[model samples]
Target: MTKRSEVHWRVSEFESGQPFIVMEQYAGDELDLFKKFIGFDLPDGTSLDEAKQIRDLLSRKLIRVSET
Candidate 1:
C-alpha cells in the first residue's frame, strides 16, 4: 500500500484589508514527497491585474516571514 501526505494552510486578511495565505500545518510521513498547490479566484469586481498584484504582494510577504 502507498501512503499520502497532506499540507494545511490558512487564509486571512491584514489590518489594511488585504488577504494573505499562510502554511498552518502538515501531516505526513514524507514532507519531501508531497506536492503543494495554491490557487486564487478573482472576485466579481476584481480585475486580472489587481488580482495579480494582490497575489504578488502576498507571496512576497509570506516569503519574508519564512525567511525570518
Candidate 2:
C-alpha cells in the first residue's frame, strides 16, 4: 500500500460549543492517517501551531492545505 503525501482542507472553522477542534471536509486518502499533531492531547497546547509550521515550510515546496 502507498500513502498519500498531500491533503486538502475543505473547511476549517472553530466551534465554541465543541470540546475538541474539528477539521471538516478534509480530503486525503492516506496521508491524513500518518499526520502527527503535537498538541492533540494537551489542552493548552495548540495543535494549530504544528499545522501552521508544517504549512509554512511545505506550502512553497509541496501541497499542504492548512488553516489556523
TM-score, per-candidate, Cα-based: 0.35, 0.26
RMSD of 2: 8.5
Q: What is the C-alpha lDDT of each candidate?
A: 0.46, 0.40
The lDDT leader among the candidates is 1
* lDDT of residue 34 for candidate 2: 41
Which residue pairs clash in candidate 1? none
lDDT of 1 by residue, 1-68 (tens): 45444445445454555554444325545443333444344455554456557656755554311110
- Compared with the true structure, model 2 gives a TM-score of 0.26
lDDT (tens digit, per residue) of candidate 2 on 11-51? 12245321232222245554544456422222444466654
Instruction: Give per-residue lDDT, candidate 1, residue 15.
Output: 56
All models, RMSD in angstroms: 10.8, 8.5
User: What is the Å distance of residue 54 in model 2 from its true position?
Assistant: 7.6
Q: Which regions in candidate 2 have their CA more than 4 angstroms from the true location?
A: 8-26, 31-54, 64-68
